[model samples]
Each structure stands twice: as structure tokens, then as C-alpha cells.
Target: MNIVRIPFSILLLLLTTSCQPKNKSDKPETPQIVKETVAPKVEISLEELQNYETAYFASGCFWCVEAIFESVKGVKEVFSGYSGGTEKDPTYEQVAYGRTHHAEAVEVYYDPGVISFTELVQVFFGSHDPTTLNRQGPDRGAQYRSIAFYKNEKQKKIIISYIAQLESKNIYGRPIVTEVSEFEIFYKAEEYHQDYEKRNPNNSYIRNVSIPRLNRFKKNFKSYLKEDSH
Candidate 1:
């Protein structure tokens, strides 16, 4: 239940803009968004989804995370949302402007038959830096921090084991700071936020930040990517 308070104005500015350039040397490469024909999302009935399971992750921005998970083979849908907080039905402005404690999160609905939750956990850590506390790239705030929310003790064990293995291998220079929390309610973001990266491919923030992060994930998880993504 601990929520870090960031200056409201600074939080608003960070949420609205592309990742701020840290320094001349640390700037992310702005890659051109390749115009590709993306396949439409396959509609799944409630009965079908009942056979599947959902996982929640908060890493950096939901826009970036949503795109990453959607590209995965078994992921039925990825919804941009807010979670890891006590707020009831938090709005984007409330989370972005520091009015709510919610972190930018994504609810990943996937078929366990195609991709296991363990593999999804790998993607979560591989796609984003878990070592940076309360920050991801250019975005800095408690709401941008890394969190893996588990719905049950089994899922919690998986997350704990993976983190331990990563730590044992010393994969990160610093300790992984991702919070492993029990699952709670996830308030979906505004309509405009859904499929944002795909719909607004030419947007400044999407072009500069979201696309690059996605491409990096695609490169590493080639086997996990959908055919159209490949």
C-alpha cells in the first residue's frame, strides 16, 4: 500500500511527453516505424477466454507494454490499464497526474496452451529494465515502476522463482526492483489508449519510444512473436 508522491507538475509533464533525453550519450535510437500490415485481433468468446488465464504487469508505460504483449503468439489481447494501487476505477489523468497511486499496467489475456505464464514472465523482464526503481527510461515516477501481479499462490511462486534465478545469474548490474504483488482490480484506461501504438504509428512518442521498445523485444523473442509480427 506504499505510494510514493511525485510532484504533480513534474509527473504530468513526464506522462504527457516522450521519454526525456537523459543525455547525449544515453538517448534512445529513433528508429523509423516500418509500415507493416498488422493482422486484426482475433475475437475470442467469453467461453474461450475462460479456458485461458490473465496476467498483469506494470513496467514503464502501458503503451509500450501493451504493444509488446500483443505481439506475442498466445496473447489474445493486451489492455492498457492502471493497477497495483488501492484506487477504485482510476482514470488516466488520476494515475498520470499523481492523483491516484495506480501504476501504468497491462492486463495480458493469453492461452496457456500456446504460451505458458513462465515464458510470459521472461518476456516481462526481458523487455524492460527491472533494476531501475520507480522509473523506466525517460519516464520517472512511482506509477512507472515495475510490478508483476499474480492472481494466485502458484503464479506468485513462478514470479519469485524466476526473479531468484535472474538474481543468481546476476543478469542485471543492479538488483531487480520489480514488485511482485497479489493481483487486484485493473481499471482499463480510456478508449483512446487502446491500440494506441498501432493506431497512431506516426505519433512522436510512439515513433520515438514505443516502437523502439517493441522492436527490441521482437528481436529477442523471435520464437514468441506472432507470424505477422515476424
Candidate 2:
């Protein structure tokens, strides 16, 4: 059998005790060893998703963003991916290291009837700090930059209007720097990244940063979450 070589940087990261990046570096490490516990299974077929509407957002680590959106009532599924850049089929390493312009993003499939696009925008802004530039919590890089993508003019108007309202209210006490871009292609992240928080419950990053961020969103938006999520 051919042995696959793991990059030294990646190996070192995995061996570290926390997913938090060292002060000298902004790379958030992940655990190399996967636990035996599996994420809860909830598979939605592609055919069934045809009736659902899609939204895309990038607010930080996809792991945290994915989990937050998944908890919402109408959200059908959330997939970690890269967006807001021109690179085609970019890898995690390329995006994570800022080698590609793409930022870590998520593709959300939700029922418009159950949840409106306006509400989804609210969740997007409510969950993460949009005022920060190219950084979220422990991860500090362009890949973690905030972005809200719109597929059409209507969606674009909604995002712009929300930002205006937030600015008017001075919600963050700073200017929101989130990017409002047109929806383009979305390259799904590697399989290991899918449901990462659920699968790696004990992971340092998951336990500390990811879970806390998710919990904060849940608390602030209690009515938006699904019953099972609580």
C-alpha cells in the first residue's frame, strides 16, 4: 500500500493541544485522530432539496458557521465550502493559508416557506461579528473574512438594507466590514470537514471556540432555532 504523506505543518497542527493558532501564526489546527462517535444522521436527498432555496455566507471558520446555520428552524442542510473568490476547485490548504482568495463559506439549503430570506440574513449577521476584518476569534486570516452572497437583486437589496439598519442602530459600535457579493460557485470542503463539530466534540477548537460561538448564537436567537437543536 502506498503511504500518503501528511504535510509537516498540518501534522504539527494536528498534534497541538488546541485548535487556536499560535500567536505567531493564524492557522487554526485540527485534531488528526477522529473519535469513534459519529454525527447525528439526517440525510436530505438532492431531489428533495430541489424545492428548497439556497443561501451562502462566510463569517469565519466554516465549522462554526455550518453548525450555527444548521440549528435554525428552516435550514435543511449546511455544507462547508469556499467562496467569494475566482479560484476554481481550491483546496482547504490553499484557502486556509490565503494562497487563494476564497474565504471559508457555507452553502445553506432551507425551505423558503418555513423561513424567509430576510430572516436568514438576520441569522447571518447576528451570529458573527461583521465589523472585524479578515479575522474571527482565534483564526486570523483573509480566509475567515465575513461575506454575504446574493444570487439576485432582491437578495442584494435585503443584505444592503440590513447592513444599513445595523449601521443606523450602531449595533456593533463599529463599521460593519462584511462583503456583499454576488453568488458564484461553491466548492465543497473535504469530507472530513463536514459536521466537524458534531463528530469531533472533544476537539479543542470545537470545545472552546466553535461550541461557544454556536451557543452564543442560539441564546441570542432562541426563536430561530429548531426544537431538536435546543
- In model 2, the clashing pairs are none
Number of clashing residue pairs, candidate 1: 0
lDDT of 2 by residue, 19-121 (tens): 3234344654532445546555466788988878999999988989999999999999999999999989998767776778999999999999898999899
Give all candidates' CA lDDT scores. Answer: 0.79, 0.81
Lowest summed lDDT over 10 consecutive residues: which window, candidate 1? 1-10
Residue 49 lDDT in candidate 2: 84
In candidate 2, which residue ranges exceed 4 Å CA deviation?
A: 1-42
Per-residue CA lDDT of model 1 for 1-230, tens digit only, reads 11111111223234445432223353344323333435444446878777778999999888899999999999988889999889898876567655578899999999998999988998888888888888887788888999999999999999999888888777775688999999879998866677878877887778777887788788777888999998
Cα lDDT for residue 24, model 2? 46
The model with the greatest TM-score is 2
